[model samples]
Target: MDDIVKQALAKWPNVPHCTGWLLLDRRGNWRMRDEAAQAAGAPGEPIRHTALLGFINRNYEADDAGQWFFQNGPQRVYVELGYTPFVVRLAANDPSGQLTLTDQADAAFEPSAVYLDDEGGILFTNRSTPARVAVLHDHDLDLFSEHADLASDGRGGEFRWRDGAVLKLEPVRKSEVEKRFAFVASPAAYAATNPDNASR
Candidate 1:
């Protein structure tokens, strides 16, 4: 949390939170949704202001109710997720590369769990506290494969590499992603929020 935001919260502790005003799109872009855009049920205008984006990304946070939001000074601008809460990309083009995991809010995390979706989409989570599940950006999928030191064995959804099976991953349905990862794709999708039971 930023110091200015903390001061604002302390000064105006009763400010109501704002929702449906911001969005984190599937490709890792932050968007601002207006009333019409929010009602139309689609992504809003992409926020390209570098300073504003930096502030939002810096103050982003999630509540105990599984609601992700940006602490905009005194008020909370809740984010509407277009996909999972996170998006990861290959950090380097090494023979066996590492991942750069960032949530919709742009906070970095160390990937702790790596899996694939039914469509062969990569899914991962953080190693630290409050783990958030995320999908690897599609544009980086080929880049990941090229340098990840990975090879798909002659088996369905099976992967093998020099270090043996890094993970015995299987494909999972997109519909089950939220439940499997303990996150809300949209604000309205938030059901239960028991952090203890959230997939680590």
Candidate 2:
């Protein structure tokens, strides 16, 4: 959390949280959804301001309920996820040739486990207390395929990292990702069903 955001929370505690206004797309873009867009069920405009993006990334966090949000000074702006909470991509200029992964926030991610979804989506999970999951960027799939030894059934595989670490890839169904990872895909929809979790 940012110091300014912490001060704002201390100064004005209980500022109601807002949802259905921001989104994190599968491609790692932050989008701002307006009332019109929300009503039409459309993905909002992509947020391109560099400084604003940094601020949001700095304060992004998840609640005990597994709903991710950006601490916008005083109010919490919950993010609607298009996929997993984090979208990772291969880090640039990694001299070691090891396929380093960095989350959308541009932070280093060390996977404790990896999975291949039914649709060929690659998922990585870190060893954090609650565990954080990320989806590899689609553009990097070809590069990853070159390093993986997949099974005949395409259900399991072994990935050889440039650093000489071999990881066993497990199979997972796309529809079970949310429950398996303990994350809410749509916070607004979740709050609607669990009225007690909603902020008025």
Candidate 3:
């Protein structure tokens, strides 16, 4: 949390929490949902301001209940996830020739679990830290192919690291990702009945 945001919270402790107004899309774009867009079930217009995007990314966090939000000064703007809470991209290092995963928030994490969907979607998450999972953007499939050591998993292909690192990964169902990945990609569905169990 930023010091300025903390001070704002202290000064205005009763600010109302906003929901269904912000979205993080699959391509790592921050979108602002207007009233019309919310009613139409859309991700709304892309927020293109560089400073605002940076502020939101810097203050992005999750509550104890698994609800991800951006602490915008004093008010908490809950995010509506378009895919996963994070969207990660793969990049190859020039010196080491090693691949790394950087999330929508621009933080790199070691991928511990990798799953490939029938639609050729690449899912990855670190079993350590926060356990936030991400789907590689469709545009980056080529980049992902460059790093993945793919093998036949009987159904679809599975990924293996370059150094013969073998990790366990099952064919996970997209609908059952909440149980399999432990993070909520869609939050609005559970907002009325069980806000806290958004991911569950």
How would you encode candidate 2's per-residue C-alpha lDDT over 90-196 as one tens digit per residue? 64355756578899988998888889999989999988988999999999898888788999999999887656788899999999999899998899998899998
TM-scores across all candidates?
0.79, 0.96, 0.86
Error of 1 at 151 (Å): 9.3
Clash count in backbone of candidate 1: 0
Clashing pairs in 1: none
After superposing candidate 1, which stretches have Cα over 4 Å from the reference?
94-108, 147-165, 188-200
* Model 2 segments more than 4 A misplaced: 91-95
In what order do the candidates fall by TM-score, top score first?
Answer: 2, 3, 1
CA lDDT, candidate 1, residue 28: 84
Cα lDDT tens digits for candidate 1, 84-197:
776665555267544355555556656555676766677776666777777888887776565343335512343232234354455667779977777666663333343443
Cα RMSD of predicted structure 1: 5.4
Give the per-residue lDDT digits (tens) of candidate 3, residues 1-200: 88999999999988878788899997989999999999999879999898898899999988876778899999988888877788888877799877777887688867888887665677888766767788887877887665555556533454655576755545667777766766555456546668665332
Residue 70 shift from truth in candidate 1, angstroms: 0.5
Report lDDT per candidate. Answer: 0.70, 0.91, 0.77
Local lDDT at 69 for model 2: 93
For candidate 2, the per-residue lDDT at 188 reads: 94
What is candidate 2's CA lDDT for residue 50?
97
